[model samples]
Target: MDEQRPAHILVVDDDREIRELVGDYLERNGFRVSHAGDGRQMNAVLATRAPVDLIVLDLMLPGEDGLSIFRRLRAESRSPVPVLMLTARSDDVDRIIGLELGADDYLAKPFVPRELVARIRAVLRRVRMLPPSALAESAVRTIRFGDWRLDLLQRNLIDRGGVVTPLGGAEYGLLRLFLDHPQHIFSRDQLLAQLARREFEIEDRSIDLRVSRLRRRLGDHARDPRYIRTVRNEGYVFAQPVSYEA
Candidate 1:
């Protein structure tokens, strides 16, 4: 998030009342807010307006659902902005899918506007959390492991086929931490201390969820993993041997 100016936020929801309420609340809290009723309007705002720092996307829409929009955004956008999914449904599956697909955070409906504001700040903080010196291993420029290459300068992952994959803020941070100390097991608390934004946390499940997402980007299966392996009650470890390149 840009500290010099009010962060720009795009609120994408079909309900006019909800959109107005959210946009007004965000503006009141010192944000530059824009409204979008659906995927089409959302795209238009993105294409025409100034760059948005974060997006407040609703999961349930009239034509194209929020998940589809999010997926396309990740695949198409060169610099994917942080996304916070707003869903009326209580199903864990929707939440998991959103997280795995690189959403910054998620909130359920009937939420207090205050809580939403807090989450939005937390997600933005995570995005700007890592400094250039955060990763000691990053001085090497590139880190290679398994069948993938991590361009530290670009802050992206690339497959052997040369396809690039974007990593969310937390995902990039967690992966860098693991690469910095491969074969070293880090308990959940240790990992949390390294990555926590010092903001309000929903639960410890947040750490687990982020680790799972990183593993997915590394093409590591949760059950039969190759790169990041579960250490049972101990926590997790980046088992692969990482090599550095200048």
Candidate 2:
């Protein structure tokens, strides 16, 4: 992400070996790296000259663990840095808690360093993943689709009530696909294909769950929906006209 800026990333782990290993690997990947043995050390690193784009944090620590640090970060910091939680447990609860608490991603301990690098790159890439022509879009300004006023460049979505709702990863992707191809009936498989190109994914159920989640974000009730309509035996349809100003 920010290839020219050389992403500044801080590694926080009680394990000295882990801290250096991760820091060195990230530095070798052409990123600026900082290491901290604990949460206090992490705080010191955050006060450095160069800003940190992301953090690789271990779940267990000598005193302040990754989850604790994450809570403190949300409570205290003005700017929230994306976090990749490192854990030794394969517990689903750990993963769920980390995600629920705003972690961008997670890595189990004893993972491939190469995969680690890839995950880091992927997470950072999202922050800088705007299309090459995004600047032009921002310059021209507004995009409206049916009753939804989507600020394409700003990544802002305003509904019919003028309420600004925050959308997560998969929700935005699905919404974008539906908006881009209004009136087209796409099977779940087709939707999955489109999303797979953008992000790492799993089963068709993941797509359904994302759609359900998106509906919640859009404040759409299944009984009486305004935007997305479901076909009982067929696939999903974007049932509305999407218009763009920019």
Candidate 3:
């Protein structure tokens, strides 16, 4: 067997101190770290270097903000690369927007280095834990409900008109969980535990935000959801009957 390589992480931030601090810390913790001062530098690194496993992006930048860079990354890249956003503590709106744009996770500014390491580990753990057999099986099966088809192998969500919607890692995991257990109401804690592969602090609102984003993707209205329904005083449920094909 070939030797497994350390995960390569790209740190994109305009702040020199922060970029160096995070890069050094992550490198000390066994990750291969690269630094970029802004979006242009980030794009150059991505274009020239080996494939990056994840990105630690700062929300605020001098030019071409993190959000715009993230949007472009998702739209242009051939594969999905998990993004962990760094935002100001008060920038709740930006945080939510980043999540909706398919960010894998986010941390507030002035965060502890240890906490950042923890979050990075959690995201990478989820990404690396997929077994070959499971991936093969999922690739052959496509789950269908209402007008949406979820290709297990490709991890793509296809609509009735055949437009493919992109999903973040957490979004895909949560949706698959719901599809696998249609009509089973899952509590906030239960969902969090299922999706969070490692010990990480996640707020209840984060779950709500992910569900909202998934609902929009499915064309399921929040007020009258045809697929994922919010059970009163209970957790959400997949309301539609699901079928699968291999």
Candidate 4:
């Protein structure tokens, strides 16, 4: 262990058995585990100095569901840590919903500890692999595309009239990739690799959905698109040239 791998995983679940077991398992596997019983506990723990690197959030919490907590954190307009949803629901629709809600990974109940550890490692690796240029800097840069202005430092989307739009974790990553490499047609696989930094999770169509959300925020008409253009056979392209002010 490097003793400074730079990761703080927050595990939230209502079941004490699951929480303790999962926390212990993750700890033994070289993770700094912080456990919470509910959304309130999660918030309280997050209020302390140690910034959470990722979240292992259960869906059916006692008072506030995982979605609500995720939303509350997202509403603060900051880039949320990547979430790994732990759910009992095995439905495809449920999985899709979680993915849409910005969960970086999903693990159904009765999952092996190894699988969970693997997912955690993948997400943590993504965190570590972020280029130093993206978020850490003195002066933040702004990139304008149609009706949207992306503030890299603040991790926000401002409309043409200057109303700020909050970005989900995965959405923020995808936008960062596009802004970093504009006009290049990247296939879904390439986009996922670039965005997740090799943290493999979710179906490939999730890329389409994330891009769709960005397009909606930009008010870019799908029928007559201006920003991200979809290629029939190849992939998608960020149609606008990006400018960054350091």
Q: Highest TM-score: which candidate?
A: 3
Q: For each candidate, what is the lDDT? A: 0.79, 0.73, 0.79, 0.74
lDDT of 1 by residue, 129-223 (tens): 43434324435688888899988888889999999988766778789878765665666765665565322232477888887878778778768
lDDT of 1 at 143: 82
Residue pairs whose backbone atoms clash in candidate 2: none
lDDT of 2 by residue, 93-115 (tens): 56557655656677778888888
TM-score of 1: 0.57
Error of 3 at 122 (Å): 0.9
Candidate 3: stretches off by over 4 Å: 1-3, 130-246
- TM-score quality measure for candidate 3: 0.58
lDDT of 1: 0.79
TM-score, ranked from best to worst: 3, 1, 2, 4
lDDT (Cα, 0-100) at 129 in candidate 1 = 44
Estimated TM-score per prediction? Answer: 0.57, 0.56, 0.58, 0.54
- Cα lDDT of model 4 by residue, 1-246, tens digit: 132764678999999998899888888887888999999999899899887888999988899988788777767745667788888845545554665555666777889999889878765654444444434445547766566788876789998788998787777777766665455556676676555552534367778888888778777898977888898876787777655556
What CA RMSD would you report for each candidate?
A: 12.5, 11.5, 11.8, 11.6
Misplaced by over 4 Å in model 4 are: 1-6, 132-246
RMSD of 3: 11.8
